[model samples]
Target: MRPIPHPGRPGKLLRLLAEKYPTKEAVMSRLIYLQGQLVLPKGVEHFMSDLHGEYAAFYHILNNCSGVIREKVDYVFGARMSKEEKAEFCTLIYYPKEKIEQMTAARRATPAWYRENIARCLALARLMSWKYPASRLPGLIPARLRPVLVELLATRPEADAAQLAYQQRLLASIVQADAGAEFLEDFASLVKRLAVAEFHFVGDFFDRGGRPDAILDRVMALPEVDIEWGNHDVLWMGAALGSPACIATVVRNSLRYDNVDVLERGYGISLRPLVTFAQHLYPDEAPIRAAERAATILLFKVEGALIERNPDLGMANRRLLHCIDFRNVCAVLPSGRYELRKAYFPTIDEDAVDPYVLTLEEREILDGLVTSFTESPSLRRHVDFLYRKGSLYLVRNGNLLFHGCVPLTEDGAFCEITYDGKKYAGRAWLDFCDQMARAAYLYHEQEALDFMYFLWCGRLSPLSGREVRTFERTFLADKTTWEEPADPYYRLLDDEETCERVLKEFGLSPKKGHIINGHVPVKVKKGESPVKAGGRAIIIDGGFCKAYHEKTGISGFTLISNSRGLRLLAHQKIADVRTALADNGDIESVSETVELATIHTTVGDTDKGRAMQEEITDLYNLLLAYQNGVLKPQA
Candidate 1:
């Protein structure tokens, strides 16, 4: 696999920009354009976290841009359109292709229907395009339809009778030509692009809800996106990098959640070999449980092996396979001896020389699984996407975005973690983890792979602040023994001083910089607020997965940051796509203004804006170089 290239350093980038704009005239023209863009309202950013493979809900939230589209619909149509009419119109924008197909199939898609919708779509696009510059609108529209649509959007159709009639004729021509569906699809794409300038997926795009693979496919199609690696996401990344423990854990999780389809249908990884092996070895257990049990054993074995090889991973305590007494059907732990959930361990022999070592059959099954996970084309594409777009943490637009905690010690300081004979904490540690994760994929080294697995559940891993007691939870009958304590970071989250320290460590303004994270669900039903540290940090995981809904008391949360500052949208349950198309079913999102910008924020105030300023500076230099005869212009 070709390694993904990192962005050039500032000097290198400036050199490249200078080369691109050779002449003084070209440099001046580019500088003027970029400078002009600085004052415009920065596009709205939509933040969602812990999607957990809920594709339908994710798709709807993404299409509707967290109710921003519906709000725009209301703003556009107002009292002229009734409630039902607005709902239908919004539904059309959300699922234009599907709605068009539905109408055509029902024999209700008349030329007049196409003309009306086309007009409405144009109106909505015009409204959305206001947030963006006119120059940017053409790029947002479909290439095939850009020339015609750009002309229509240049002026308001309702400005004069001539303009209105010309627009009407254009709409009619589209309908007459029977290209309304294609036109509407393009319009929908344009509107969606305009509605949200960027999407920040703050982690956990994999596991639980059955279609993380589908979620990734949708995310990949978006124009701009950044992902903060969640623990579950890192597990899959590790698996794709050929970590045997990670692969086993991925499979075990798939089986435990009854999400076998995600493995077999989604990624095309065959579970047949493991299933046949499990069923033959443990015939009395249900097939799924048997497979899960088999995978769990394989997981422990590999984890144990990894721990033994790399004692620095700090997971020696997790090698509990050696503590199990087969005859007694119990495991000795620090607390006490606990009875195993299932005594039938056909593959385990406590009397063996090394209990953590995989048996011949287990080894073959794991080797097959590793091959399947590492070589699956679909899985590779998704993992590549993750690596290309994801990191352990991100600092964007004066805010910090990460999937989990910053790893704080009990004394409210950044937790010091030792890795590769060096101690690192806070941002440095996360950066190291990110590099190792990339190295695991790029070099496929055993140490890097082990570190990647550690990021999934290591105690000090920024992605997973909790100590996962998978062994205890799976085998111990005592519920008391199953408690997995979270790191002190969780306890310190509500402390303003602690949060400020974290912000400062990341080189953000502690006074203005807010930490946005997701991993643990915020239980709203229990009167818990996602906002913590007096609103300096916000945890937006409200549970998109059905399994977490009961615990979180909300379908999901979306954070929107636009010119006006940040607001959070708490969504209720969204109906399936069928209902969305047929009945205009939409997720009802309650919006709360988290921070109202004291002054309207412009593109000049953003990270991108700062980068643009650098380019403008470079252009000025290039112009000087050309004028001084230091560099020649293209003839």
Candidate 2:
């Protein structure tokens, strides 16, 4: 892999920048351009969470910028463009390829329409690009269209008619060459890229919805984004790393939701081994009604082994297979003896001692499944992207982003865990777990890989937070056994002191920093507020997964933080993306002001801004070194 050049490259910074900006004019011009960008408004930061494989909705939010684009369009065009025209423009910008094809098919290519819309897109791009540094604008534009875009943006509205005519003629030539549609498509993408400075995924990108792969495609291409790994995301990531426990969970959950298409089609993973194993083990048993009991029994044994291995994980009593009196067709539970919902388990192997162990055929199938998980190129690529750009939690620009809780004890204190003979809690514990997660993929040792299993469901895991009752939920006839306790962190959310302590532990100012997180949905339908800890913390996950839309009663929540203030936007439920687009209906969003700064925030307030300021200081030092004759000044 080659190392890519970024804004700040340490040690040889003077030499590196000297290559491109050898002339003093070039260096000084860039410094001036950057200095100018600093005073201008900060680019907006968009925060989204729990997309959960709803590709179309995710695409809508990314394309429309949660109605930010619409507002900008209204501001830019207003009464100059009619309502109908504004709809068409927004649709084209969001779905350029499809909209262009529709236009070309419906009406023959008209130079006037092409010319006008291209100008509209360029205008929006111009608005988005203003706050960006002038030096970086060229790189953001496509090579073939760069000069025209530059001309369009750089031309003053007060320019002479002759100069304006030249710009018009250039566009006419583009349309005459039949490249208008493709050009606008590229330009539209460029507009979307520049519209938001950074994209943040608060977590849970897989399961419950279709097409996580599509979402990953956009995520991978984004110029800047960060992810906080959600529990479900870790489940899939663990499977991709060949953890058998995770593999079982993924397969079972996918099957439970009838989402096998995600596995067989989206990821191209063959489930033949499992299919054959099921056949071989069950031997064509008649009536799935009777066979489901046997299937459930086998599943219990598998889940039981996982729970029994980690007894102190708070699920030791989840092992219920041994308590089953096969002869009597019942299982004993803490609540009392319960009658089996479905009996007749032919594959129980009652006389055998270790019922928790997988059969020979079952082992072979599991090995094959593990192979498929680890060997699938597509699955590995997406998980690799997650590993590259994600973490358990991130503290950025005075806000803390995490998918799950910090793992608190019953009494509302940090749950300490000993690793390498050292007790770790709070931020240090999270850092240690992150390292262990990475090592789980890099190293082949059983201990390393097994740690992925622990992090996925262990009671003390910040990612898992509570004991997972997989065995109890699948096998128990008692509904009481199905209850998995919520993490204490969930209940302590309104504690300002707790939230402040968390912020301080992460090295953020307790007063200024905020915890912006989501794992559990904010049940707005039930009157649960997302803002907690007396406004020190916020949960933005509002169930982007269609499966939860009914329960959550809203599409999801997004945060937009720009120069002026921080605002929270809530989206209404989406029926269908194609239908919504065809009707020219945007995801109707309502926003509430979370904070309005007395003074607009600037780039200097951001983490990247600090990095840039350091670079500016370094450049000044380089200038000094050149004057002192330690390094020669470039021409």
Best by lDDT: 1
Predicted model with the maximum TM-score = 1
Displacement of the residue 569 alpha carbon in candidate 1, Å: 0.6
How close is every model to the real structure, measured as TM-score? 0.96, 0.91
State the lDDT of candidate 2 residue by residue for 1-635, as single tens digits.
12223333235867776676666666566666556666767778999889989898888888887888888899889999999889878888888888887788889448888999988887788777877877778888778777877777776545788867877887788899898987888888888878788999988898878788888998998888999988888889888998777787777666666566788998987765565555555665533322333335545666677766655344566567777777787877677787776565555677778778777766776788889999999999999999999998998888999988897877778888775468888888889888878887778465556666677777777776877776666655778777888788988989998899888889999887889988788888888888888778888999898888888889999998898888898888542458545766677776878878899888878887777777666566555555555556665
Error of 1 at 68 (Å): 0.7
Q: How well does candidate 2 match the true structure, expressed as C-alpha RMSD? A: 4.5
Q: Across residues 1-635, which tens digit of lDDT does each residue of candidate 1 receive?
A: 12123332334654677678766678777877888899999889989999999998998888888899999999998998999989988898888888888888999988888888888888888878877866777788889988888887875556799887887788878888888888888988898899999999999988888999999999999998999999999999999889998999999999999999999999999999999999998898898888998899888888988989988878778788888878998999877999988788788776787888788999898888888998899999999999999998999999899998888889998878887799998889889889999999899999999988899998878899888899999888888988888999888899999999999999999989999999999998899999999889999999999998899889999999999989998897776779898789898877889999989999999999999987676676666656656566876
Error of 1 at 587 (Å): 0.9
Count backbone overlaps in model 2. 0
Flag regions of model 2 displaced more than 4 Å: 1-34, 279-317, 344-346, 419-421, 575-577, 632-635
